[model samples]
Target: MKNEGMERLGKDELSAKDSYYINVMRGLSILRVVLVHLGLSWFYPPYSQYIGIFLPVLFFVSGAVSYYSFLRAQSVGEYLVKRLVLVLVPFYVFAALVLLITVVFYPERFPSGIGVVSWLLVWPNFSDVFFPLNQVWFINCLVVMILISGPIFFITKKRPWLLWGVIIFSLVVSLLNVPFPLYAAVSEYSFFSRLRWGHQAWQVLVLLGLFICGSVHYRYLAGQSAKKYALISIVFLIFALMGYFYSDLGFELKEHAKQRSLYYLFLSFFAIYFLLALERPILRILARMRSLEWLLLYTNRYAYSVYLSHTLVLFYVEQWLGLTDLGGQPFLALVRMFLVLVITLAVAKPLGDLSRTLAHTVRAKLLNGIIGGVRT
Candidate 1:
């Protein structure tokens, strides 16, 4: 009912200063995601290489926000309940809607009934059920990351060294190749199995490390002096540039596609840190454009909805107009991306409102039930 989009950083959770730059960054990231998915990178090859930072930045932001929320939570149970509703409900609602549409209009692409059941259960089958729901992987992964953060936060509240150890361990695991036997065993079980310890397992580890990095940055470094910020920015820029060149040279060939190790992770970190370091300058530039400021703010506010729904809209647009053949045409690509943006926002706005309302309603009911049971 409140119409806020997925409540990325509410007033209660973040101060205005803290939330503003985050909103801007998130807005930019979601826009980049939509553009990249629309094949924007095809027209400009370097775009793909540069945009790798977006997802990592998103995870970092999620980590910071999740940490703050965890701090304010009364109990782990309550926090987990709230998080599950907020994160998963929108995903399920929109995913089901997309599935139904695909079944009705493009049934050939829809998965079998068993696959549908598996998808509804959030079971990861190696099937087409996840194709349309591709981008929602971030949501799926975020839910797991946030769940892990709770225990990590509690355990490492006093022992900062333990937190670093966990991060280091995650990094080490991400860098190592999973044994062939282990990979083969996990590949056969189910989606959950794959998600837990298959190819995606490395992704989870890397994300966990980035999440911790974000949490640590927010806790300790968010309010540093301008000089310190500039120094940090310069250092991050140096590494980011180096990583960019390294990626260009193809030294880390899989870095572009798989992004499994510390090499790519450092690239992401450099980008995020540079963004943080330049926040003041970015805000200053944004201040000069009143209309652009409002636009970015609105985009930031509705980012979750946009991210969730944009791919579906893009798919429909491509199918309807046969845009696949227009790849090399820069003008057409931009036009197609613009149209996708327009249509995605149109659909996402209402769905996002519904998701927010449903999540809030569910939370209220659950909290009331818990309170009533205790009172009784």
Candidate 2:
């Protein structure tokens, strides 16, 4: 019995070390989002749906990561401050830089009063204010999710039945195929969401569900063997396939995944499970290729910045490429992909670094100081 107990603890230690895999997922998700924005979802139908689980993967991963943060923080205030800085610091810096560039380089396109003020707040669909930053919709959602997450975590720990009820309501919203959109906001082109402000009040189940799935995984599923994860993945895959054809629970049109359904949750769960099942093999490969590992780490380091700024890079690249027939011109599509990735990294990395620096300063000078003052 003692030996078995020791083995379980050892497995958990290894799992904690392998937490870096979360970054690998983030790096891949951002790249997939870039591809989605570049018209891959429109032109390439085959694998897009598979990779389009990117958004779900991100939310789940965020939930899991936030669980770790939730465990460590000394108080709720520290936790929120950390969360806010983690997202908003780099974003505000990026917005300021973008606004400056527009003013100097594209004065006619310079934002006016509301557009100027909009930069201070993050919203799901800000395309009218500035088209390039449309992708920050993801950021907007994350901010709200983080704000509400503390209490949710408390319920999960203290009131399982209450949490389960919330989960049921969320799933009911998902299964009902509600026309209220969450992520896409009230945009006209969304899957079916026609109602206003659904993003705020109604979660469409998939969004909140992924976060819960992630939180649960952090608590109960973190240290499983690859085979265990693979088995779990198989179960989710069967459910996804079954749910897809029967209930239209997966993708809205099986083309663009702007709208998610209960089916997509199963699909995303499968994808994350499969990723976890790759634990041993991926580590082996990364061990042999230090450079590749470094690249993955680097990609993740600025992934948030990339998510916030990549569409901006895509817009410029498309303009430079003459907005040509990319579907017909394979090479141009490749060029578009390359230029977007390269230019995006060049522009985004600095903002990412600066954001972290600012956040760190804020933590030390503001957050920590406030906590200390209160204690003193």
Question: Where does the lowest 10-residue lDDT sum fall in candidate 1?
Answer: 1-10
Cα lDDT tens digits for candidate 2, 51-140: 666567788778777766766676666777777788888888887777777777778777667666656666433544345565676677
Error of 2 at 282 (Å): 1.9
Query: What's every prediction's RMSD, in angstroms?
Result: 5.9, 4.4
> Which residue pairs collide, candidate 2?
249-263
Task: Tell me how far the alpha carbon of residue 65 in candidate 1 is from the true structure, in angstroms, after superposition.
Answer: 0.9
What lDDT score goes with residue 31 in model 2? 73
Q: What shift in Å separates residue 12 of candidate 1 from its native position after superposition?
A: 9.2
Off by over 4 Å in 1: 1-13, 46-48, 108-114, 121-132, 175-197, 233-249, 252-259, 371-376
For 8-106, candidate 1 gives per-residue lDDT tens digits of 323235657877788888887787888778775555555555566556788887777777776677666666767677877777677678688768876
lDDT of each: 0.68, 0.69
What is candidate 2's TM-score against the reference? 0.84
